[model samples]
Target: VTGSPGAVITLDTTAGVVFQLNPQTFPALDMAGADDIHLRNLSGSEFSTSVNLVADITTLADGVTPIGNNKYFNLVIWGGQNRTGQTSHLYCNLPIGQYGKQGDAIVDAEKFSVHTIPNDFRGVGFLIGELTFQFSSGGGGTWALIQERVLLGHFPILIPGGGTTTIISTFVDSSFEIFGNLDDTKRIAFQADSITTGTTRIITMADVNVDLADIATNNAKVSNVTHTGDVTGATALTLDLNNLGTETSIASGDFLAMVDITDSGSEKITFDNLQANIVKTGALNSGSITSGFGNIDIGSSTIDAGTIDGTAVTATTQLVSNIWKDINALDVKAEYTGSQTGHADFDGTDDSVSIADREEYDGTGVF
Candidate 1:
C-alpha cells in the first residue's frame, strides 16, 4: 500500500495466516470498497502490484485460468479515443495474435464507458467504443488487445422521376483524365449523358453503298479504252499522251505495249486530248514502263486496236511489236497530189512534201 508523501507499506504472508486492511486505520481515512485503494510495492520483482492492475476491472473474470496454450484475454472498452487514426476510437500497444481472446493470462483488460444525454453532446465528435484481446506465455512481455469501432448518422437521398431507383453521384467539383492506347479490337463508347462504367467502347465503319438508280446518267466515252458496262451513244474516247514521256508502258489484261520511247529521256509521248473511258490505253509512251527489256508490251492487240505512229514513219499492225523498231520501219502511204511537174526534196518541211523520198530542185524541179 502507498500513502501520500513517501510513506510505503508492506505485505507479509505466513503459513495458515491471512491479513487484511481496514479503511479506519492509521493515516488512512474514508477508504472503502475497491474504489479508493492504492498500492506502492515498487520493487522490480513479481511482487509489484502494478503488473496486472487496469483502469477498469470488467475485462478480468472473477474465476479464470492463469496460463496455458490457446489462452484468452479479451478487452471490451467503450468511449476511448482511437488516437492513432487507424480506427475511430482510442487504442494503443495492441498485440497481434492475442488481441481478441477471452481472459486467461496474467493481465486483464482496461475497459471504460461513457453515457451522454444526447443534448449535452450534440455536435461533439467524441470517442465511441473499443475492444481488445491479447494473450501470452511466461515471458517478461504481457501482450495487450486494442480495438475501436465507431458509428455515424445517415444522409438524405434525393429521388428523380419517381419511378426508377437510380444511383446518383454528386461530386464536389472534381475532374480526372485517363489516357491509354487504342487498337482495332478495343474501343470507347458513350454511356448515358454523364455516366460511364465499362472498361472501353468500340466504334465501327463499313463500305459506303451508293444508290445511283434515281440520278440522271452521264454520256461515257469508250474506244481505245475498254467499257465494262454500257456506253451506248457516247462520244469516241481517246487516250492522250499529253505530258506523258517515252520509256513508259501501259498494259491491260494480258496485252502490254511500249511506244514513242526515247533514249535522251527528254522528249515524251503526247496524247493531246484523251476522252474518258473504263478502257486503258498502254502506249509505248509515258504510262507504265518496266526497264531492262522492251519499251512496252500490249498484251493482246486483238482486243485493243489503234494506229501506231512515229516520227520517222507510220505503221499499222494488229499486234504491238518493239517500240523503236516499228517507228524506224514506217511505210510512207500519203502520196504527193500537188502539181509542180517534177519532184522536189520531199519538202517535208513544207506542206507539199510527199510520202516519197525523191526531191526535184531548180525552177523546173529535179526528178
Candidate 2:
C-alpha cells in the first residue's frame, strides 16, 4: 500500500510489498536509512519462486524539506546477492514535471519494480541498500540529454585551443555561416603578435563599412594613402616632419601637393609655375633694390646719403643733369671771387680792381 516519508518496505520469498507515494501531496521523502529492503532466506520448496517489490517515489528532498519545481531527478538502485557474490546497479532519470505544486496535472510520478530470484535449490538471501535519488531543477536533466545527443552526432568536435584555431577546425571542409545579425559587442579581435601588450584590433560590421566613429584610438595605422577626392575635416591636419623624407634643395620642376577648391579635388603644382604666378601679381619682383631698380617705384620717398660720388652716379634723368650744373656754377663763382692779378672783385655794393702796373695788365701782373 501507501508509505509515508522514511517508510520501510521489506520483501520475502513468500510475500510481496507495494508502495504508493504522491510527491505533490507529501512534504518530502528521505528514505536513506529506512528504505533498505531485507530479503529472508528462501526455503527448499520456495527456491524456484521470485520475490517482486514495487516502489513509487514522487517527491525529492534535500534534507527534511522538499525543494525544487519542474525538477527531473535521477534514481540509482544498487544491490548484491551474498550467496552468489553478484553485484550490479541500475540508473535512470525521471521525466520533466511540476513536483512542487499540489493537484498539478503535470506532476511526474515514477514507479520502480525489483525482482529477486534465488541462486539455486540452496537457501539464499539478498540485501538491497542505499537507494539514492538525485534531483536537478529547471530541466537540467533534459538539457544534459540534449547536449549528450548533439555531441554524439554533431560534426567537427571542439577541442582546447585558441579561438582562431578552433574556428579553422570547425569549418575545415565547409564555410562557416551565421544566420543572425551581430552587434558591436559581438566582434572578432585579432593581434599581430603574441605579446601581452601588443595592439589589438576588433573587426565588426561597422569596421567592414569603414565607419570612423566606431574606430578605436591608435588602431588605424596606414602606411601610405592616395586619394583623388577632397579630404576635408573640421580641424586642421598636421603632418609629422620626422616621418617624411628630407630635401636639402628644391628644383623648379619639383611638385607640391595642394587642394583645388575650384574643382573640389586634389592637385599638384610645380615650383616654376608657382613662382611665375607670384611674380606677375606680387608687390616685389626681386630680392634686392639694386637688382630690381627698374621695377621699383620709389614714389615720394626721401634718399639720405653722406656722399653722392660723381663716378658712381649716372645722369639717367634731367634731375641728375641739373644737379651737376648747379654744383659747377658754384665752383666758377668761388674762383672768380678769389684775388687775381687783373681780375676785378665785385662786392654786393662796391666794385674794386687791384693792378700792380701797366705791365701787369699786359702779361706780368701781381696784386
Task: Identify the leading candidate in terms of lDDT.
Answer: 1
lDDT for 140 in candidate 1 is 34
Lowest lDDT block of 10, candidate 1: 154-163
lDDT of 2: 0.26
lDDT (C-alpha, whole model) for all candidates: 0.28, 0.26
Model 1, residue 205: what's the lDDT?
55
lDDT of candidate 1 over 223-268, digit per residue (tens) = 3443244323333433365443333333443322322333334333
Q: What does each candidate score in C-alpha RMSD? A: 24.9, 24.3
Q: Give the TM-score of candidate 2.
A: 0.19
